[model samples]
Target chain A: MNFSDIEILFVEDSMDDATLTIRALKKGGLANKLHHVKDGAEALDFLYCKGVYTGRSINDHLKVILLDLKMPKVSGMEVLEKVKSDPLFKSIPVVILTSSKEDPDIKRCYELGANSYIVKPVDSDNFFQAIKDLSFYWMISNQPPHHL
Target chain B: MKRILENFIPFLFVMLSAFLIAVFFLVLSNIKTLDETKNLVEETYTIINLNEDVLIDVISIESSIRGFLLVDSDSFLKPYENSIKNIESKLLLLKMVTEDRDTDGKADELQRLIILRIADTKNSIINHKQNNLTIEQKIKITLEGKKLSDKIKNVIQEINSRQLALLAQRKHDNIDSDTNLKLIVGVLILVILFLILVGFAILKIQQQKNKLTDELKKSNNLFSTLFEHNPACISLVRISDHKIIKVNNSFVDLLGYSSADEIIGKSENDLNLIVETSDVEAIAKLIQENQIVKNYEMQVRTKNGTLIWTSASIIMMEVENIPCVVSVSMDINAIKKSEEKLLAVNRELEAFSYSVSHDLRAPLRAIGGYATILIEDYKDVIDADGNGFLKSMLQSSKTMGNLIDDLLAFSRLGRSEMVVSEIDMNSLVKTVVFEQLKNDAEKIDIQILNLPSAIGQPTLIKQVWVNLISNAVKYSQHKPNQKIEISSFQKNGQTVYFIKDNGVGFDMQYYNKLFGVFQRLHSKEEFEGTGIGLAIVQKVISRHNGTVWAESKINEGSTFYFSLPKIKIKTK
Candidate 1:
């Protein structure tokens, strides 16, 4: 797979949550351009084009970055902070898709410049619907600044 | 010392008066002595004058005798006889002048000598008249008369000189007494001035004492009133002995004692008021550090041996120069009981919700997700019955997952801090209605009247509107013509907003269970619901310090009403 072709960088710690989300994105026919990282560290590695992701290109324009809050080694909050604070990556849209419907987490995610925050519903069908809608909105419906 | 001075002032006045009286008596006696000296000096002068007159009368008698002898005339004899009578009268007057004390008998001797001279004059006069005298005999008689007259003159001279000396001495004594009286008077004046100043000082001191006594009395009254009537139980414990020196009425009542006498002079340990020895030691340590222990909650035993919670504050102070600790305690039994119960319930709810949200939901999601995936990916491998079982598993998981989410949201309502502000009810309701009935706009007829602004937490109030509006739409879906009426009114200082709907309402008898968690009036087949929508509505409205109730009839309609305080309606 070409690293520059990746549009969605999905970061989540739970394998089950990741599989369900990826499968929903795949069902929406957007998985070919999407990439999944098991934890926040791998997401940063992919974004910075470091470690095993050294072949990845930093110049690639991404459609949306999906993040989860609790992860090993690093957190999605830190990943979001890094991406939003950097001038090169600041215009990229970030979405928080996590099981935590906690008010503080949602508030903090927005405060850290998350474009959208969605709680992953416990019902599979509803979760699938939420993932499909967000992917479609972020990838196709919402206009990227690069096109603008 | 002041008391002693107060007592001594009167005695000092008495002594001062006695001294003044004695000085007055001394002055009186000195004045008497001066008067007597003046009388003595006057008497001496008078005696001298009378003695001189006696001398002059004797001379007159001698002269008259000589004249008779020389002139041999009867006129001369008449003068001589007059001289003789005058001489006798003058002698009697001189004697009376010296009557009080005949110092040297000089007055009487002078009188006797004057009489002798007069008799001598008479003899001479007789001889002259008879013409029986020779020249030699006449000379001899004259000489004897001369001698006798000289002796009389000497006696008068001696008496006069002595009287003159006595007058001088008495004059000197008078001067001495005048000076002595002046000195005594000067000393008396000084003493009087000193006494006056002392009296003034004493009076000023007395006035200050009276003022201080009044102030002390007032302060004492204030202290006793505050100490006895203060609501907090207060006691003064001596530092050295740890004995309760004083306890107020509140303390007596708090300790279940009939009188203060039962508690006073008793230590906290003796009364068993300190339930834990560690608390006493901790307070002791705090006091040693001079720290003011404030609102330290502890358990203490009362007189009846019942333990009660109290928030006590202790401070070290001095009362009447004795080091003591003043402990003020408030009975917090009711607050403590409620606090404990609340904390326990909160802790259990938090733990339960946390596990439900973090633990139960993920596995339930996995079960449902896996079942769906199996049905989708391997439709042929799963037979009809197997697909049915998988479908049930998926359905049950979804239901359980929903139950957990609703439960978490309900518990979060209790745990979350609410930030209340002015809510624009009209705009808020319009938004919720649009969102809830956006797709059903063609079928549902909804009328919205103007709603007054209210004071509430915005998010929670939004949740209330969401739950009620959704419930209204859900229940009335079967009706061919659906209607929802949203309006507001002012009543009893509250802004009451209600949602009326024509729906398949439940019986009023089930109204008790209407707002309870997971309580569904209709079967799942008839109206699909998790039964948390109305409960959430009730919870949210109640959290806003408002009331929520519905009027309903079976197969007719239901109207849900909630009120909010109108105090902050004008708040921006």
Candidate 2:
């Protein structure tokens, strides 16, 4: 995926989190064509090109799956597991975006094959820097599983 | 030797001596009757001796008459007749003597001798007339007469001599008897003297005994007075009846009465010493057996209508050779009150611990929530150092949350009421392991093994499994396979629960901190934790009256073990 298709897929439960996440991604210069979902369930549906995201092709361009752990329904861990387990979307990097550092589910995410895990910092600059670091790794350095 | 004695009550000795003396006097009276029968036989023998003397005199007279008849002169005949008359009178006198003395056989033998003499005289006269010329014949007759007369004389003398010898023997026996009687009198006198001396000595000894008894009575009275005055309750009871034989002034005072006289004859049951009559099963026991109920507590009713709790130690005894029970007493109301106060203090301590756990969580949540809000709302404008500073601030919030959680876990240990039951450790671990896996939508390979059912509170016990299993997953977050094997079984009367985790292990030196509140070996940035998971696990196990410990080395995975009491609970 090139910089044009490297728009962020932010999956978070908190509305405040999604807004702050978008702002942080934009500040890192990696926010073009930002797509958002409220929970892990929606993130899965969109990644599989089903539900509201039907007919969408994840093959041409998905940059990163930014997921949150604690949500109303499907947790970020569930999304991570579902997406990483599928041949169609396992190549796409999934980063956990959670409010709880002690989520206890973080290890499960890593075990489920999430590409990266990050804790949402309450401080603005730390939150921004973490976003920047993940975007740089996925878009530039992390050469996505060499296209089949 | 030390004299083994009881309290010598005098009646036992007096009654024993009285029986012995009555048997001795009865034997002495039987010996005196046997001496009187021998004296009557001697008096009858003396009367036979007098009869024998009269018979001898009659035979002499008969010989004289035969001599006179041989003279053949008229004048001589007249004289002889007179002599015969005299002899007859003498004979009559002998007969009278024989009758008086009861010797008739001796008198008849004398008459037969006289009659034979008369017949011989007549035959001699005839022979003289017929043989006119026989001088020699006459001479021979005379000689024969002389011989006959001599024979008669010898017979009378022999009879007298025999009678005299017998009389002398009787006299000798009497003299010998007199000597023997003297010896008997001396012995009897000695015996009587000894008896008099003994009786006098006994009287003196009895007087001394009486004096000593009086002194002992005085000492016993003084001792009893001491007991009465000694400022403590004392009582004496007669064993035969369940009645108070004696009650001291102290006891009388305690019962609020003026004198022991009022309390005498009253028993424990009558005075209500055993306030609840039904509780006197021990009283029945005391009655059935000889027992000393020592250091027992009981409520006794007083004369003033109040009950007092008394602690007493009772003893079994024989007073005046009769068994009785005595007891020493003390009051114990203060100790009871203090015990109740101690229970109240424990309850207050429990309440304080509960409040401490509840108060800790609110501030912690606010700190964590607000910190995240700050980071999310203003992340765009922060500089590099500002970013690091914000991260540290978030670290501080996380640390506080962990502290709060750890404190809650520690306090919960005190509040969780124990509900002991049998729990299957194997099935339980499988379920917990699967929950850990499924709850996260993770495929982290897990392992479990040999588990056993243990007696413990299931809900609290599940916490132990959850915490240990979650700890394995968290620490092994960076490891591949993420294998966790859980096996528990019973051994040595305890159900041991174990979890082995292949994770970034810890130093054995810091193993002590594994189950402590807020004890953490890894930094929060390396492994996300509240630091209270194992602590909660430790607390849970301990509430079941168990223990939690871990063995690990740096870089080697940790193995955690715990044990629960192997109590078997009934299903029904």
Candidate 3:
């Protein structure tokens, strides 16, 4: 839940994709204090200090949130809107992870202040490389705002 | 007009007069001749002396003689003298009826002699002074009387013979009269028979004539009735030039013609009512084929020169044993205009779908590209939490890019031409799977089962095998012994290929939508896909006249089956 403490907050619904992503991040040397959650709702709870993440601070600066667009409860689009609308957490970059490249969704995500979008590859090696590239580019290179 | 009046005949009166005159003449002649001939024959058969006429005279005297014979009681003898005188007078009359030629002239002499003799016999009887004469005296007296009578009788016979000979001679000489009479009688009989036969024959002929006249009247009534009250426009068309021979009231009303006579004896071209240039040709063709056009549509010009669209069909028939066409027309113009309007609508829909696709995707590529750059170029300035957020944003943009790409691919598949050729599928599947496997540093065993070489579009069909086999390899990567088997067999004239893997499979319920463009059963964090792979597989198979399906269970592996028809597959 603490973004300053964690380098990667991987909000995903699948364990295998999460494992591969983490492995790619480590291989790319971008895996520092990587934290993972199962869904958008839990990611929101962790971010806004609600429910299980209530003990956490309200505005903890984070470098990147690798968000899967499709998730249970709150979706990535909803999470993106909440974060981008809040000045307290607006500077934290959110990257959309998805399988489809449907145009309307991409337009909507970008309009909602998503920093970037990435499609998961079907090729195992390319998928692994995509994770590596996503982690290295977003976590190791991207900048974030100071604490609120 | 002049000939029409001339053609009419009053045959009934002429026939009746001829018949009655002949009958009257025949009846008049036969009556006069039959009467004269019957009377003449009766008189020629009369007899003489002992004849019925003579006997009648004798009986008259008998009454007086009976009174005279009873004279002894009174004066009966006085009446006997009178009776003898009466009998002598009758004998004289009989003697006068002589057949001999000499006696005919001496009739008086003979009569005197017969009377004297009769008196002598009477005197002798009276002198004997008896009511009955003695037999010898009676015999001697009757003999004397008979002897004298015989002499007179011979003379009378000669006279009778002469008269008979004369009558027969006259009869022989009257042959000319007989012939003339027979001629008159035969003529009379023949005329009567002829008159009777004529009367009977004339009656039958009159009856037959009446029936024929009635039929003619009925036919004329029917013809005139149809000309006045028909639903269809009727026209008499002359065969030589197709001129209107005569037009009915219906034709005049329907065509807006002034009068039947005005339209009569004029060609169709003179009316100028036909719309199509080929109207005459169509009619000619119809005639050649002997076809009856029931409700055909064509244009026509009204009498006022207004163009009228009508469905006109024709029937060819005989009128007074002459060929002509009858046309029935109905209006139909609105439907043709609506059909033209609908054709325009379909073109608009096609243009709209394409324009929407083009305008939408241009901006997507830009948004996706810039996002990736920001995350890549400025990652170091970001904190861990900030970095995580940027990374997710970058992933989202790439996902968007994949979404766009998958959508485009799906649409492109719809119209892509599939050129089928002989495909070495064993090599094709091997190469595709091997390329995927080569990326992984770990060596995995993929046992390729029986593979086939078949005809298909190599590029598209290769995509099918590649997607299926690569997916198999990807899912089973974590297994202790990662293995995938590829095999093919023929069934019902089709080649069905199977790809089996020991990997994490899906539930059957989710499999239904698995081959749709963006229908994904697994989460993004597990199996990475745009969900268009199976869709491409399905499309390529269909292009080759094929089908794709799968069988799976959670925790167990899956087997993908794709079948392709072995026909000459034109992948278009």
Candidate 4:
């Protein structure tokens, strides 16, 4: 679990949803160098190098963070707020992957500097395809900052 | 009050001047009468003095004549002639003074006697001068002369007495006139004093009346200014006829009229001011019941025929003893339009949230992702019961996904814009029933009855028919005969379409929950449904300004009725 090697951070509270998302990413051949956290608090801890992540390098930034809106403890909105406010990790791209395309949530995510917002589709085939395309776009098509 | 005084003051002045004029004429007449009396007294005194002078002249003539007889000389005759000449002139003066009819006869008799006496004396003197008569003859002539003198003295006495009587009468008349003048002058002074007092009182009353009038004018001006310049639209209408009695500037401007005269005598109906006559009736009823209507909303058609909404506050008032309704209206058209827009936006937002929740089925179904992976990865290791449990989990998740989709569709029906057109209900129902029963294995019998055409969005109405017909077919699938009937008829100017199914119906007491979103009367095992079909049907029909209702009895068939207004067809 070297923090420096982690390029994609997935923050989701539902283990099943996380498994599906990771499987989709793995199917797209983008699961290597990916890290998954149970909720927003673990995501923040890992990003800021706190608690169990204290021995990790603080300068290590993920290429992109897939943030879910609703979670236990610290919500994705709070995580985005902390990460976007900090000059050290503000350049890291955040993609809001949530079960809703609600206007207010999407609007607020963008206002908090979310790079992308996508609503999860109800159909399993569409959901899998959406996740695969998003992973490919962020990991392969899009260029990451040199610090990542 | 001041106006009354203003009229009274001039009248009072005129009356006082007339009184003064009357008094002035009375005093002038009295002074003229006194002057006439004074002149008459002076004339009477002159007449008496002239009478005395004539008597003295006669006496002197007699003495001169006697002296001429005694001396028989020319000097005595000279004195006699002088005396005679003086006597003649004195006699003429007396005659002139006594020319009035009452004294003229007396003065003439005195003149005759004096002439006879002078003549007798002259004859005697002539006899003495000739020395032709005895002394007895002279004595007799003298006696005759004396006798004539006595007659003359009597005549003079009578004329003097007449003059004295006239003087007494004139003095009495003068005293009477003086008393009358004093009485008239006293009465005139009292009358003028009374008139002056009355004039002063009138002046005071006039001043008070003028003051009141000034105050009234000031208040009236203030009221008119407020009425004419107030920012809110205000009108006074006669209560009996609803006639506009007066309208302020704002009211005129609000109605897009140039002058109040255009609207003053017109009734609300005459001007077509109220868009809904029913609202007018309602307001009238309220006013009759309460004598006041406050914050009543209505649409007003302006002068240009543009309808605008307003909130009015009206109260009954008395104007010039006539009952009138004074109404103040505020332009609420902008607020009303914005409010409706806001409600529409809110509905859209609600629909968006439902659509967003529809997206939650993705993660919800993903919750079975682990089971899916288990069945795929450990197909041989898992027992049959374990595999069955995982499959049920997946099935439940899929069922939930279907429910979310149905819920989203229901919410979207609320937010979607409707494109209204003429729809052929007969073909629409037939197509829906055919599609719903295409793959059915049950011996279902659906009788499509005669259906009337309707005006609505074809797509939405088709969806409503599809839901209702499919529900009928699905519910009656357990029946051995499986009879479903679709029919439509006209009811209350609306085309009512109903779907009848011989299925396991619900109790009438739970009818309220039949169309509720996610409400289910049967368990999932008994009837496989998301419980959103009736809710969607209700929403779609309601969007067309129609209604949906159902009549059912437990263990009996159900009839779902939905109605759409039957618009009158126009003939070209």
Candidate 5:
């Protein structure tokens, strides 16, 4: 597979949440040319094309990055900070998709230049619908910066 | 010192009066002595005059007797008789004037001489008239008369000399008394002047004392007014005895006593005022260390035996040279009760949010996800009945999810801090209405009228507008026109924003359940809702210190009204 064709970067820790999100995206016809990372460190590795992702092309750009707050190592806020601080990745849209809407980190994410915030619904149908809508809005409808 | 001065003043005055009275008596005695001297001098002069008259009468009798013996005539006899009569009377007057024993002796000898002279003259005259007297007999009578006259002269001289001596002594006494009186009067004048000076000094001292007393009274009045009218309970307690020396009206009222008299002069322990004696001991220890006890909360027992909460600030103060603890306390029972209630509500809310977030959502997600997987992955094996049941189960879980989200949002509305700003209601309502209508297929004729600006938390107020406008659109969807009007006006200093909807309105009798959480006026078949939207709307509007109400008639229309404070722009 060519890494330059990848357009969606999904970062999440829970296998169950990731499977459901990928399933929803696939159903919504947005799963093609996507990349998945288990934690913030792996997400960083994938973004900078470092460590296990060194074989990937550095010139490849992701259309959108979906971040989760709670994780096992190197939390999502640190990942957002690292990506948003770098000039190369700062223009890329960041969408926070998490289970908790009550987490105060939602405001911090927005303050750190997050493009959108969405709370995962407890019901599978609503959750799928929310992911489908987010994918359509961020990847299909929103206009990306020319540099990205 | 002042009391001693007050006592001495009257004593000094009394002594001064006594001295004045003594001087008056001395002046009166001196005057009496002068008067006695004057009377004695007058008596001496009269005695001398009487003595001289007696001498003249004796000389006249002697001269007339000799003339009668030589001329042997009646005229000489007449002079002799007249002389004898006048000499006797003059001798009596002399005796009366010389009433004193020393002068009376002289007067008696003078009288005997006059009588002898008169007898001798009568014998000579008889001898000459009878022609039986020889010249030698007449001459012998004349010699006897001369002897008597000489003796009278000696006695008269003696009486005059004694009167002269008496007059001289009296004159000396008068001079002495006059000098003594002058000295006494001079001393009296000096004493009177001294007394006047002392009286003036006493008056000045009395004026100063009166001024000081008035000043003391004014300060006492001020202190009493401040103490009695103070809003907080105040009391002064003596450190040594723990006796309540003074208590304000507020203190008496706080203790449920009739007056300050009921609390004053009684120790806190004696009156059973403090619920815990240990608290008093703690405060006393603090004051003894010269440390102030600030906001020391404790229980205090009222006169009616009810215990209430109090927050007291106590410090040691010097009052009238004695160290005392001045305590100022507030009756904080109401505040404490409200604080406890708030704490309990917060705990309940915490537990509620926890359950909503963790326990409720986890099971709900499992139910919905597992149902969806069963239907999707096991589609060929499952029958129509199983599929329908799974679909219903999925639908129910989705509804439950929405319900949970709404509940969480409602609860979060209370916990979230408000970010207040000036909100343009016109644009805010337009945005919410536009966003809400973006996904809906049905046409909503939203007439957003001229809406004024307001002061509120923008995000919360936006939620309120979203809820109201969406409710209007959902409830009024059945109408053919589906007309909804949004407008605002200033009412009684508040900006009232309203959404008027022509919908299948509910009965007015159920208005009480309109804004309650989870309260539904219509069944799910009629309208799909978690019934938490209006409750959230009410919560948000109320958090802004505004009101939410609805005016509706069944099938006629409904108007939802919410009022917020108008923003005031401060001008410099």
Candidate 6:
């Protein structure tokens, strides 16, 4: 599969959550340039153009990254830390999409330079609307920095 | 050394008094001896003078008689008469003077011989005057007179020599006594000087000792006052035996003992006071390392067998040269109870929030999402009843989700740390009011008075305003002319803000359930709410060290009020 021209790197561990998010993005017509990774490790690999994503151009910067907090191997915090710390990718907007609506987690994500934090609502419609609105905001309404 | 110093002054006083008394007696005896020697010397001189006078008179008589006999004139006879009168008086004086020294009747013999000589001289004189005496007879008489004269001279010499000897011995005694008196006085002066020096030193030492004793007494009183009367329970335990050597009133009271005697002289183990022996060991270890241990929390059993929590500070010290631990314990049972209670509550809230946010929400989301997907994808294939069931399932999940969210918010209100500052209530209420009404602000008759500033966490206070304003707006929505009044008043040093709305207010019978979580007086069909709004308001207000209450009359109006402290609470 072609990895270039990817605007959104969606990282999530739960397949059900990932499917619903992708469906919401698809419904919004924002799924074409988006690439989904299962965990933080895979997301980092894709970002650094390593592992299965080797040979992907480094200059193809992501416009936004939707990161989940709780994951299997490498957590979303680690991914967010690495991406935000790297000067090359720090400019990319990272939105935290998690089911945990804890205050400390939200504060920590923001403190770690997250652009936005959204709780995956228990109600399907609200969650669907949240995803739809977030994707639309990042894709169209928000003006991305040059090189991001 | 201190003991010796304590006894030294009195001992020195007694010794000095004894020495002075002895010196007084010595001087008195010496004076008496000198007086006796003086009298003896005077008596010896008087006796010697009397003896010499007698001898001189005898010699004169002898010479006068011889002159008279040799001249044989009337002038010679007159001289002889005067000589005889002088001889009698002189002999009487010699006899009187030599009475004390009449050894072997020497005075008597001398007197008799002097009389005989005088008689012989008279006879010679009579014979010469009458011309009836020869020269041989006169010569005989003169010879006898010479003999008497010689004897008289010998006796006078003997008496004078004896008196002289007595005077010389008395003089020797006087000199000896004078030397003795001088030596005694010199020695006494030296001894007195030495004693004075010793007395001064002893006095100085006594003064210093008195000062030290006074200070010690004062400090001892101060220490006992601070220790015994201190609110903190204090106990001294011997390190070697772990026996409680001392306990204050507070300690006795803390342990529910009858008196300090009940606790003192008993080990903590003996009394079964400390609940955990390990805690004591741990405290001992810390004290050993630091020489003091502070705020070590432990549980102890009282005499009544009631266990209580105490925050103790143990200091390693010496009491009367015995190594001991001075444990000062504060009865922290009340604080500990509240702390434990708070911890338990927080843990439960956390678990509930976690379940709601992570565990409970996930499955709810999946159920709701799958149902929606089924309805979206299999709408035509499924029957209408199945579609209705799916929709109902989605609706139930949504309601449960709202409940979970409200629960999570309520729980998080407790766990969040509050950062307090001055909150501009006038603006804060207006913002919340504007947000709640949005474009529908013109529909309701909302009156906002001049609200006072309050001290609290701004965000939490804002939430309080949001919940109260939203409730007023929601409840007053049915009124034709909905009047919502927002204002604040000062009550008991707190700024109490209330929102009054003319709406279908609930009955006062359910006032107890007003701020209870998930406790609603109205049904879902009546008011679409999870009944968490007032609960959240109450929680937010309480966290700010304030209170919340409401008054309402059914079908008339309701006024929800919450108080905010004018001053911020100092939090640790």
Candidate with top TM-score is 6
* Best prediction by DockQ: 6
What tier of docking accuracy does candidate 5 attain?
Answer: acceptable
lDDT per residue as tens, model 2, B512-550: 777776678999789877777887887787777788788
Best by lDDT: 1
lDDT of 4 by residue, B1-572 (tens): 65676677678778867877877787788789778767667767776676677667666666666665555556767756776787788777767766653675777788888777778777777777788566677567666766777777788778778877877887787788778778877887887787788678777886877898999999999999998999878999898998999999988988899899899899988888988888878987998899899999898999999998899988888999999989999889899999999999887878666556744664675656666777777879999999999888778777877766676667667766888999988888878777778877347877888988999999999988888887777777787888988898888999998989899888888889999999999898888898998888898888888999999876678999999999669799
Q: C-alpha displacement of A77 in model 5, angstroms?
A: 6.8
Angstrom error of the Cα, residue B126, model 4: value is 8.7
Q: Give lDDT: candidate 1, residue B272.
A: 85
Give Cα distance to truth, residue B89, candidate 6, Å. Answer: 28
| Model 1 local distance difference test score | 0.85
Docking class of 4: incorrect
Screening candidate 5 with a backbone cut-off below 3 angstroms (N, C-alpha, C), the clashing residue pairs are none
Model 6 over residues A1-148: C-alpha lDDT tens digits?
7777788899988777888788878888888988999998999899998999898988887889999887889999999999889998888889998776564677888888999988887677788889878977786645456533
Chain A TM-scores, candidates in order: 0.92, 0.85, 0.86, 0.90, 0.92, 0.92
Off by over 4 Å in 6: A45-63, A86-92, A100-103, A122-148, B1-352, B370-391, B487-496, B564-572
lDDT of 5 by residue, B1-572 (tens): 65776688788778877877887888788778778777777777787787777677777777887787777776876766776777677767767767664674777777777776777777777768888467787788788888888888888788888877877887787788778778878877887787787678778888998999999999999988998999889999998898999988988998899987887788988889889888978887876686799999999999999998999999888899888988999999999999889989987887667556755765677677878989999978999999999999999988887887788888889988898999888889878887988866357677888998889999999989889888988898888888998897889998888899999888999999999999999999999998999999999999999999999999978999999888899799
User: What local lDDT does model 2 show for residue B84?
Assistant: 47
TM-score comparison, 5 vs 6, better candidate: 6
The whole-model C-alpha lDDT of candidate 2 against the native structure comes to 0.65
* Standalone chain B TM-score for every prediction: 0.56, 0.46, 0.39, 0.51, 0.51, 0.50
Candidate 4 Cα misplacement greater than 4 A, ranges: A120-123, A140-142, B1-11, B14-363, B371-395, B398-515, B519-572
lDDT of 3: 0.67
Candidate 1 lDDT at A112 equals: 84
TM-score for each predicted model, relative to the true structure: 0.50, 0.41, 0.35, 0.43, 0.50, 0.53
| Winner on TM-score (1 vs 4) | 1
The model with the greater lDDT, 4 or 5, is 5
User: Model 4: what is its DockQ?
Assistant: 0.21
Q: Report the lDDT tens digits of candidate 1 across residue range B1-572.
A: 77787788899889988988888898999989888887887888888877776777777776766666556677867766776777777777777878885549877787778777877777787777687677677777767887898898899889888888877887888889889889998998898898888888888898998999999999999999998999999999998999999999988998899999998888988898888889988987887786689888899898999999999999999989999999999999999999999989998878666656766766777788888898899879989999999998998987887787788888788778889888888899999999999889889999999899888889999999999999899999999999999998998999899998999988998889999999999998898778898888888888888899889988899999999888553456
- Worst-scoring 10-residue span by lDDT in model 6 chain B: B95-104
lDDT score, candidate 5, position B118: 74
